[model samples]
Target chain A: MMHQQFQDCIDACNACADACDNCAAACLQEGHASEMARCIALNMDCAQVCRLSAALMARGSQFAAALCRVCADICRACAEECGKHSMDHCQRCAEACRRCADACARMAAA
Target chain B: MMHQQFQDCIDACNACADACDNCAAACLQEGHASEMARCIALNMDCAQVCRLSAALMARGSQFAAALCRVCADICRACAEECGKHSMDHCQRCAEACRRCADACARMAAA
Candidate 1:
């Protein structure tokens, strides 16, 4: 069974990934695609890492601890970048990134 | 400028996330949704973590180094789990995960 902490981290990561993916797509559809290049890039990147970290922790992989540490940093940066835009997608992505970052940070420390 | 190594890690994470997201959708479309419960779960997780790690590294977040460590582990486990199924989607996700895991591992140590 997944530990409570691990589960929480996974939830955070999954939620963040979904948010990023949705936001990226929305950014692209908003016709400001050029301006959203960086945001889209960051969103895509953040979603991937969050998903991977959750999978690793779920399986109790040997590298889970280490991955959590890195995932946390990525989430934070993505949050900051997403936060830069006032678009709905960016705002949502930022929140998700922040939540995932915090959860991953706790997971890393654990 | 984004460091070559960091950029590489971000690429790996992005590729993996795309692979996982596509794979997950494929799994659902194939009507194997019930059987793919675990695989879908893992894919979603892997994609999120990979994305987050890439975003974190792109901007040189303070937590980048630590997050890299966790991202590596997550990628590895996701790869293994995805590799279990012989489906094309699983195969692709597995390959992406392995590449991401290796890239993240090197980045973490650096």
Candidate 2:
């Protein structure tokens, strides 16, 4: 089944999406929210792309790999941006995004 | 502010995404899943795009309108595809997709 075939990537993506969403929301609540704008934007992008990549992979869609490439790009950008922030949420999100980017890159190559 | 500006479209997108995900899962459980392949694919695509559109609009991203345009196109396709099915899930998904498509279109234009 598709789930079995892409379990690791799906799990990674799911985690990353959640992390991105949470980080974005937390960034909004930060005292220096204006400075977190780019991080928030990238987080939103990463979350959406990760969700889409996971869904496509779960269905064994041929376009999954292509989307994975896009997701990886977004995840990496999000991770880098989040890494610049000192907030706990941002730190955690950076880790998740890195993991997801790696997973997505592997999936895209697979 | 972003939420207030895109409230209706965002709500429609969220509802349609839930409906699409449910329809896809239901289709997979159906006895003739092969026959429902297109429906499932469209559902997944619509769900991801809607989620992405909602997130972008929520952030007041400059790209929100462009993504909403794509979301509207996908929603319209998904609605038409789901409308051909007689299953209750499909019917519900079709209605949700139509509403989302309209909402996204309005958001895109605005």
Candidate 3:
């Protein structure tokens, strides 16, 4: 089990990963997917990093904070990219990423 | 659904991710966790990369090949690190990593 302090951040990371994955799939199904290429790439990276961060935290690893920092950075980037889109999936992803980034940043600072 | 060509690689990746995650949690439960610090770190990274690689392949991302190359590299490193340990989890993790590395390498070259 993760430490009590990590539960919120872990939840945020998992939710963000799900959102990113969903958004990426939605983007891929769009007619003009070429225009969403960068969004898809960032979504993949963010989802992966968030999962890693959550896993590390769950294990109580020494590197969890460091990984959380990296996770926050990618989450910020993903949020920025997704925020530019008007699609429902992208907008939801952007919100999730922002929430995750804040949670990870707080965890890293702790 | 992923292309038929990606099925084996995706399966390998998912299995490897499971192994690495299980190993990390097991390592945390073991005595002298400090000795397994590097092993745990590598396991976390390998698991994250494997999941990302699988997700990319599933979505037919253009960068899947490039990410596979990175995934293979990390899998090799994780295998080497886990190979040094005598624990059952570590041994199993090493084997999974090796298999994943081979599968990912083949995907990268495909």
DockQ of each: 0.29, 0.28, 0.16
- How does residue B10 of candidate 2 score in lDDT? 91
Cα lDDT tens digits, model 1, B1-110, are 74555887898889999999998899889977998877777777677667777777886755666766766776787789889899988999999999999998888788
Q: After superposition, which runs of candidate 3 have C-alpha atoms over 4 Å from their true positions?
A: B1-110
Q: Pick the candidate with the highest TM-score.
A: 2
Q: Is candidate 1 or candidate 2 better by TM-score?
A: 2
Candidate 2 residue spans exceeding 4 A from truth? B1-34, B50-110
Candidate 2 residue A109 Cα shift, in angstroms, is 2.2
Task: Order the candidates by TM-score, highest first.
Answer: 2, 3, 1
Best by DockQ: 1
Please give, as one word, the docking class of candidate 1.
acceptable
Candidate 3: count the clashes: 0
Choose 2 or 3, whichever is better by DockQ: 2
- TM-score of candidate 1 against the unseen true structure: 0.56
Provide the lDDT at B53 for model 2.
Answer: 79
Lowest summed lDDT across 10 adjacent residues in model 3 chain A is found at A59-68
**A1-110: candidate 3 lDDT, tens digit per residue:** 43877999999999999999999999999887899999989898888778877887887766577668767877898999999999999999999999999999999899
iRMS of each prediction: 5.7, 3.4, 5.0
